[model samples]
Target: MSSRDPSLSPTLRLRARGALANETGRFETERREAFDDGWDLPEEERLLRTEVRIERPRSALTYNRSPDLPFDRSVNPYRGCEHGCIYCFARPSHAYLNLSPGLDFETRLIARPGIAAVLERELRARSYRAAPIALGTNTDPYQPIEATHRLMREILEVLAAFRHPVAITTKGTLIERDLDLLAPMAAEGLLRVGLSVTTLDPNLSRRLEPRAPSPARRLQTIRRLAEAGVPVRAMIAPVIPGLTDSELDRLLAATAGAGAVAASWIVLRLPREVAPLLRAWAEEHYPDRAAKMLARIREIHGGRDYDPAFGKRMRGEGIWADLIARRFRLAAARHGLDRAQPPLRSDLFRPPPRPGDQLSLL
Candidate 1:
């Protein structure tokens, strides 16, 4: 892979944030930089030109006891998303690897090259119990890099072998590549997918999520999955208050038209490092409405950029949130998208046979 060159435009200047820190985790402003051009940079420095690094986790199942989450166990095949969605809540996770959550969160990626084998071993362990394993709950598993890594596919093969149920959420059109695995799994009620479409405007989408699939492409992905008999739910996530909230009904209508069976939405969240990154993004892209957007978000968050309190974190707490919620509620109801689809079957899961064990003769 060719190395990405730093921008050389005379008008270009770096925007620094507290999220930038070296491997030592020491906060130094010099380590941070960003281009305020607000337009696409040259291909050599587009930020998506990142080389993936591989890391192995001792275990793959990240057990979540949070009552707010729907699944108990989830797996992330990679860290730091290539999609470069400026509002990603997963950005802060980069700090754990001694990396910056700013540019590094997009450019510096870590993949678990052998995660599928590890997952298979864990699933075959006697103590293992299967529930619906959620993919893309944190960093997107189907991010652009998955084209070569194919970790999600390997993991899916393991899930299919053990009759394990799974739920996936992603914004990548790349998920379409796995339809063969997902279609059969969906037939058995063992799989369901949630495609998150934050906005329908291609221009807004490009600024908000530089490398993710175009909104229209995502709509096509949903249609394809639906046609393949895969259960699909449209996720209108992080509904940016003063920005995308106005499009709530239209986005829902369009997605529903494209074949989404059910729908859900979450208010914008700016937790940890994400708050500063989003503030920077707002300053860069939506300068005119940036103040209004941040203010509205703060209003919903009780004068904070974000509130991580269980249900409040997902939806937020004030009139703005309520209004958005109401609009989404009415829209979903009117469109008949308010209905909850059935959950994937957990009872179908059977622990994989352990090594050195006799094959079942039943």
Candidate 2:
């Protein structure tokens, strides 16, 4: 591979290939770094390559008791998203595996190939009670690799066979490939989808999210899903206070025009290692306004980098947050996006028969 010019800014470095540096994960007991050893080589030659490791998790469902979340359980088909959004709140999760929440979080991905089998096994348990299982809550299931792995599609097949309800959130246009499954399940009120559109500016979206689909593509995905009879919601998440917050009305308007039936927003959050990561990104990309941007974030975060407190964390707490909320509400109302779709039904759930089990007498 050709070497990238070392003189490029950090934001440009990320835009070049997803992350600025391969910092060691926080849980790692050892660390390493590179230095000039007198053999001058181009930086592009040293560009990090993405490596995916297959993980066979014993369980598929991750249950949570967090009061602020709308769902109680979620399924992550992959760990370490390739979408590589610099401000991803899920980045810190890499620490558990002794991986850096920076570059390593994006480049060194983990795929659970057996997720569908495990999900089926769990769903068939005698004690299992069906509820809407959430997908793409931590990482995008439709990330680039899914095209080859096809785990998400298999999981959907199991859900469809069992007639279980599901909810998904994603920015990947790849989800459209599964409309044959999603459309029919949605017709039964067993599925809903939310597409996150962070910003409408193509250049800004490229720099911030790096590998995720462009704003235009996401809007198209929403339109496609809505046309297929799937309930679609447009999510303007991590609404950066001074950065992308100004685009809220326009983003909502565009998605609504594309056929979204509901909308929501979450203020930008910088938790754990993500705080410094975002700070570095801002200084590199928007030096003049970096301080002002962070100051506004602090103002909403109650003078801290973040507040993990329930309910308040997602929406934040302060005048600026309140203002954003009011603006979103008004825009949604104006676009007739205030109506809520009914809850997905769990009553239709039925466990598929185990292999080699006796055939039902009926």
Candidate 3:
């Protein structure tokens, strides 16, 4: 039996033509001659190898003009996620760097070294306006490398120094390291956080989001953040229709019980190459229900893999969509989790002191 561990980040380079098929996860080996003309590679080189490498990016902040998103500007401290969720929409982004979106997306990573300084300069610019700068909107900021790189911590330092209001979304337990910063900012209403917990089942969560913090740990994060006076919202994102959708109400109740003050959810989305990649993964893991899951996703997407319409992109249209929405509302209402989280205050923002600036003696 093939090992089904999801937490391990394995590198898989393409070995041979026709070795990869949609229906199976196992690879079969065959012998080949060195003189095969159509074979671009020699038989000796057919044995594939994977090497881990790190990429450094020049600049850090990414600006977005999409009307659908709440924040106009955001920053990503890392590129290519270590948490290999098969349904991740961001996977296709790897194609821009001339890499396959499958295994490459999980193994290949980019780290920004000077992001914190760049952010400080941008935030302190003369014309820079103060609005909440979101973190972890693309790739998770607190992924495994965060412990050593400390880019997220530096970014938070800049935000804290300038009194800039900021929001964060993450699933890594590493975020707990920054509570000292977040707790105080949250005290002044300058920060808020959302924890995206997909499912409570450890087995399912293991396969769904390989490198993310365990479900129990996420619940603990909610409890700790709430205890620290930081407004915490539990986000049940990318709800797979026939798979994890069943855990909706239970997830909400559990998170609320753990002290999450607000709740939100997004239906499963199969945009771009994610559609085919997810289908391949489903066939490998749950062959029996793969077809049914795809069908349910299409039913909500109007017979298509995805619909990128502004309002309907996040939440699809149809009876299933309506049902999920209603279920979320009822569950949140029952849990007394409907209180509106106050917006982070922007009026408190003050530019940081210039270089070599002295502490005020007054």
Best by lDDT: 2
Best by TM-score, which number? 2
Residue 88 error, candidate 3, Å: 1.2
Instruction: Flag clash pairs in model 3.
Output: none
lDDT of each: 0.83, 0.88, 0.78
lDDT of 2 by residue, 1-362 (tens): 22232433223333344455556677788877544667765545343557899999899999999998999999999999888998999999998988888887888899999899999999998899999999999989999989989999999999999999999999999999999999999999899999999999999988898889998998889989999999999999989998999998899899999999999899998999889888878877788899999999999999999998998899998899899999999989998888888999999998877779898889
lDDT order, best first, reads 2, 1, 3
Q: How far out, in Å, is residue 82 in model 3?
A: 0.3
TM-scores, in order shown?
0.88, 0.94, 0.85
Q: Which window of ten consecutive residues has the lowest lDDT sum in model 2? A: 1-10
Error of 2 at 203 (Å): 0.5
On lDDT, the stronger of 2 and 3 is: 2
Higher lDDT: candidate 1 or 2?
2
Q: Model 1 residue 205 lDDT?
A: 89
Q: What is the lDDT of residue 84 in candidate 1?
A: 82
